[model samples]
Target: MELTKEQLAFFDTFGFIKLSGLLKADITWITEEFEAVFPMLEEKHDGSKRTMIVPFADQREKLCSLVDDPRIAGIAKSLLGDDFNYMGSDGNYYTGDTGWHRDGENRARRHVKIALYLDALDGSSGALRVIPGSHRLDDKFGVDVKRVSQSQTALHVAGPDVPAVALDVVPGDVLVFDHNLFHASFGGSTHRRMFTLNLCERFGEDALDELRAYILLHAHFKREHYYGSAMLRSAGPERRVHLEQVDALCGDYAERTKDLPELPLKALI
Candidate 1:
């Protein structure tokens, strides 16, 4: 469904929204796909730390098609325009707590993450928590949180101690949030199932440098291409609209990079 006027406004104002049961029909297959994808990877999650896979949705053709699902596409199209770029995705089995944090440093560009949690969750069970309106970089709340929490020494407290709304969700629900939004999850079991699809506004010719930098980040994934052959092979026109931009520059992404940025200390899924 296309977002209504108020829905758009809420995302713009609060930086996140939860759409319950939007993926209910596909949940069963999504569950199968999630289970199927992990064994392809050599890494095993022993409940010690977060286990992650990049280009997550592409691992299974069914999961890759989620980008074309009307409800999923609508959310991305509504905020990012018809020509949005499909940035990438991540799948995870999270262990312990995820400290409060923002996902990116680009202030001029905006991106949104569509998160799917495959298990029932609450604040104390790894439900996503967010500080509303925190994406407004220049605002007082945004600046203050960034200042105090960037080092965490000034706050001198744990992430869950900070005030915020804990978003409760079930298996079929979906959560969308601005990449700049301050969010975290805590008090969870060792194995929390989750995955995300990321989308962002199309860059203008003048912003190609920024676009290149964003594409370069795929280096950390240890990948030579952004999307998998499955995503590209199955993409129809609408999906192609989102995939074309990234495909232009990712052909030899890994070989081109002299060094990859250090992986995140804590894996974010």
Candidate 2:
């Protein structure tokens, strides 16, 4: 399941790579599990805006095993390293278009996102679009793309019109990209189904604080821990390697966020 040298090079240079039908054989049960998770949550999508659930795959045992899947783990290990940490996941029902933006500006530790879309999509139907090499924040091309895309008006062009690669995909296709890469989607159905697995290089002693800060951001989802019970319970030694680091550092998350005002459920999106 490991990526080839050329695939690795493509990802390194362009910030993204698409593995068509990587999960095709398993898409049936995968989609079943995906549909089952939404009802287990407190909020539901009504086609008004986006509805998302954090630690998504963690909610179901079958979904939790996705991290243990060789195809997924291999990709993460290839891009970030064997000791990569699982940064949590989100399942979503998206409405309308998403403007260009980077998931995070993670200069210290490289992070990659593995996206699985449940429906067929293309450039005109909300496929993921990425500006190649935009993950290299240190480069001029990366800097210019970020600047212009962030403010569409500066280029006098709409988001969909921006120059980028549109990654069309159907159920089971996998899209992996660096967290710093600029990406967007346009002209999609109201209930486009998708979910993501975020993984990153394990933090060094010097970066533990930064890691803690990042873990704390999960509080916005009202999460007490990054991994749900099913996720932790299903992990064998191999999968445990990805969960342990974050689990060790998130012990006080609930105590730290206990007093924060409760947000409306919709705000969790």
Which runs of model 1 end up more than 4 angstroms from their true locations?
147-152, 257-269
lDDT of 1 by residue, 1-269 (tens): 79998999999999999998888888998988998877765556778888887778977788999999989999988999989999988889999888878887557767999999999999989899998998888888788878435435777676777788999998899999999899988888899999999999888878877777787755455555777677888899989999888888776676765464333234444
| Top candidate, metric lDDT | 2
Q: After superposition, how far is residue 124 of candidate 2 from its true place, in Å?
A: 0.4
For model 1, what is the C-alpha lDDT against the true structure? Answer: 0.83
Q: How many residue pairs of model 1 clash at the backbone?
A: 0
lDDT (CA) per prediction: 0.83, 0.87
Best by TM-score: 2
Q: For candidate 2, lDDT tens digit of each residue in 1-269? A: 78999999999899999999999999999999999988765567888999887778989999989898999999988888888999888889999899999998888889999999999999999999999999999898877887646565688788888888999999989999999999999999999999999999999978888888888875565457767889988889999999999889878877877775443365344
